[model samples]
Target: MKKKITVILKKNLVNLGSVGSIVKVSSGYAFNYLIPYNFAQLATVGRVRHYNMFLSIKQKKLNEIQSKLQIISQKLNKITKISVKKKIGNNNQIFGSVSDKEIILNLFDITGEKLDKKHLYFPDIKKIGIYNLDITLASDIKLNIKLQILPAFI
Candidate 1:
């Protein structure tokens, strides 16, 4: 019978496994190549415990971020309308078309929260008028807020 030993991977390897994963391989491979190259380490009790603790801490951080986003989502949902001011050119036309970056900045100013542009689904905003704004916070969280574009002398 070929002797096999269990080891924890230090880095992801093609055709093997990801980092921190415990895998059993032939003794020769583990001792000769994997151990010598620093690709893996013996899966001791202390190392496994440390990895589990690290995973728990990482999970906690992710949960905190999700909760913070939930609070921001609630605040945004309460918003009924948001207005954007823009420079106007001749014939009362907007000097330049509104962009996603500008909208994100306006949202931050109003809510004091940073938003990613990928969450926005914009409407035609060439002229100044009221338009429906679509923002997707997550797969299940969506918000529709009224947006008004007004002309500014500046």
Candidate 2:
């Protein structure tokens, strides 16, 4: 049975090319994954038309936000100072850990930008001095921030 579907594109669907394109997909796929993963919705005639117009507005808003982020990223990229305090012994191992959440929080306080924790990459940062963080703002937008972690005196 053919059903009207409204798919709210999320994370820039490979096929959709944007974040609000509502296209018709099979009912089974819609119910099984798209809805659950928050990739789409039921595009009734009314909803479809509404979403189409909304898409333009969303694009405009996103463009504006992206432009602002670009300027911020440029400033952040030049930053080369970050200090993370920790308690450690002679072994140079940190008694506590520096989490991505803390990093994001610190960055937010500094840049006025809410950085997503997932976008903060840390393969290994046990004993840190200075590290480079690669953050993804959007599909095409990205930023690099410096993280300086220092050991807190006991």
Candidate 3:
């Protein structure tokens, strides 16, 4: 017979803590993944007895990280203005339309944030103008950005 257990999560678990919250899970999985790896601990009577201490430490750490993330989010929330330079023909059409990979690289060059090309919302940008884009930063954070497209200087 296998026994189940609850644990105080010290970090992000599949469906657990925002850093430090308690949740219930299977004993074997908890022992194998949570305990050994130190991501969580058994919510035994003794551990629960000292839950306050655990919570205090975890909350302090989470508070600090939240502060830093808030700052980063502020910067991210500010609309990012990016200008793309492309080669164009007679009809203002790019010989080769700009790609998300190119835009991602340019974003990295400007902001130092490593964003995947898939995150850019635009399917294909073939003309010059201001466009809005959405970037998924992990499961919890998403960002919006703008790009200013222009023809490349010959």
Ranking by lDDT: 1, 3, 2
Which 10-residue span in candidate 3 carries the lowest summed lDDT? 70-79
- What are the lDDT scores of the predictions, listed in order? 0.87, 0.72, 0.75
Model number with the top lDDT: 1
lDDT of 3 by residue, 1-154 (tens): 4587888887886667665577877888898888999999767778776887777888999878667656656666764677888888776777777788888788767666666666567747777777887776545667777887787787
Cα miss at 92, model 1 (Å)?
A: 5.1
Root-mean-square deviation of every model: 3.2, 7.5, 7.1
Worst 10-residue stretch by lDDT in candidate 1?
87-96
**Per-residue lDDT of model 1, residues 1-154, tens digit only:** 5599889999999978999888999989999999999999988899889989998999999889788879989889878988888887777678778888988888888899899999999876787888888999888778998888998864
lDDT of 2 by residue, 1-154 (tens): 7675556666577866576665677678879988888777666678768877887898999889989878867766766665677777666777667888878777767777786677677657777477777788666767666777787776
Q: Candidate 1 has which clashing residue pairs, if any?
A: none
For candidate 2, give the lDDT of residue 83. Answer: 65
lDDT for model 3, please.
0.75
